[model samples]
Target: MTGLSPVFPEAVLWDMDGTLLDTEPIWDEAMDALAARHGVPMTPQLRRATLGNNSVDALTKVYDAARLPESGRDFDADEAWMVAMVVKLFARELPWRPGAVALLDLVAAAEIPMVLVTNTMREVADIAIETIGAHRFVATVCGDEVAVGKPAPDIYLRAAEIVGAAPGDCLAIEDSPTGAAAAHAAGVPNLVVPSQIPVAAASKRVFRQTLAGLTVDDLARLFAQARTDTPA
Candidate 1:
């Protein structure tokens, strides 16, 4: 909280998994189970590679790591298994990242339009949204709905469109490098709050330790700083 008056962006684009929810460990657990099914261990490198990936891409990485032949792989079945596993785990509980609830509360109070942009498929994203309260967002753009997921800018672009905001007028809040890269590619400045992994500094990316006590004014300042720092 600051004395500075609030300066709101046209809209806010939010990353779901590692950003708003503490679901990375749940994904890791599911991935480990998937590896076991493949008769392979989920090594650290493999888990790292899968972070921030969509179900299909993450499965592909795991299969590649397992050294399984492409012809032997059953992607459709494996993807179903992975998503089911995660869904079951997600049903148990969806924890919020520190201060996430507060920030969402603040944003809602400000009456700022928010959109969820996630690499998670619609099936699972819908579940998470239910837990987070779907009414909070004007709309949601999932990986399955788009031709490609994060690191592609498609999801972010779509989210902005849904909010009726230009990319430059919106602020993207992300946790992973993959999500940050997508926001950057969309030419949308971001407030990066790294969750599971470190994100590299970029021209329009502002790093923060946590979202706790962050006021709308802080968001405005961060957005403005990113816009100014970004290369013309």
Candidate 2:
């Protein structure tokens, strides 16, 4: 894990899938179901490719792996089915990552604004917000709403905009390489706490095995060490 200072940022951007919630397994479940329908097992390589990908992108990877004729209609059916599966799972239970709630509480207490940045579509992102408690964030940026998805930084940049902060003034907490890369690309420093998938180290970010026991004091320190200036 990289070291950080004790200063809190002007705002914080949260990643939904693996960072705030333990929903990656639910996503994997949906993907596996899709693969089974195509007569293919959810192999390791295929699973890796889907990590941090938008839902449609994940389905496309499965389609390519199964060599299915990805007619538009066929893709729509599969995507809707996967979305339904995930919605059902969310209805059953909302799994929060360790310390996710506590960290959110801390941020809320500090009165610092936050934004949700996720690759999930808006409808599903709504479910996540409800389950996690909607009052925590000032804005939510979903995959379908952005021109590009994770690793492209469009969603994150939009999130920063929604929160009325420059990218350099926001702190992003992410759980995957794609989310981290997106935040980094948007000129936001991030704290990467890997969930089901591991995230690699990069400039202007910190990595941890988990967010357990993290406090505002810790975040302040991390932000202090993080670079505040983004290249133009």
Candidate 3:
């Protein structure tokens, strides 16, 4: 038994953007504006590549796509601009993902600690947190606070450390391939609820069409199944 639940996972690590909230379209708008500012359009391919990317990485990709001179690029300035634009869009209305609120309530009722683990910077993520209610999380770990973002284990590892749980003992809820890959690299089993793009099947990963009507027991089952599916 872990915490108040008779399950292997002691805590839940949640992704913010597409997992808990429908903020991807907001990001699309901001990234499109950014691409236009750089004298290029936001192609479907570029948008897909930037999904789940941190500010720095996404900005770099945008610059590359624009064919901008590397010597003339200002990473810090561009990152600030992007975050500002996203924050402006986020301010309008932050919508929750389907069943996200209900599932959060169920998990809280079970007395399991939850942490917000996102590749978004604190400035931008705080707005979404407000919509989701900061009271629901025990901690919030962001990309700017870590040495590296998703697709690397640093963010997930840091989140686990904050909650004092081993990676394998934590269940991650992710919606993007980048986030799932990070959790997998950290040895954490994740329940993948794809929001925009399809995530390929892999060890320590389980899929769900949506979070609608998911129960606490389902979480336990998913965690156990991922552990079982993983190689010893």
Q: Could you give the C-alpha RMSD of every candidate to the true structure, in order shown?
A: 2.5, 3.7, 2.7
Best by lDDT: 3
Ranking by lDDT: 3, 1, 2
Per-residue accuracy of model 1 over 1-232 as CA lDDT, tens digit each: 5676656789999999988999999988998999999888998878877789877888888788788998988989988887898888989889999999999989889899999889998888889999898889899889999888878888989988888889989999999888998999999999999987888888888989999889887888898898878434
Q: How many clashing pairs in candidate 3?
A: 0
Q: Estimate, for each residue in 30-89, the C-alpha lDDT of model 3 and write its tens digit.
A: 999989989999999999889999888888899999988989689988888888888889
Question: TM-scores of the models, in the given order?
Answer: 0.94, 0.91, 0.95
Model 1, position 143, has a per-residue lDDT of 93
Candidate 1 residue-wise lDDT at 112: 91
Q: Which of 1 and 2 is ahead in TM-score? A: 1
**Order of models, best TM-score first:** 3, 1, 2
lDDT of every model, 2 decimals: 0.88, 0.83, 0.91
What residue runs in model 1 are displaced by over 4 Å at the alpha carbon?
1-6, 230-232
Question: What digit string (tens of lDDT, one per residue) describes model 2 on residues 1-232?
Answer: 4574355788989999888999888888887888898888999889987888886678778778888774633867777887787888888687889989999999899888988889998877788889887778888889989998988889988988887888887889998878888888998998889887677667788766778898888887777666643323
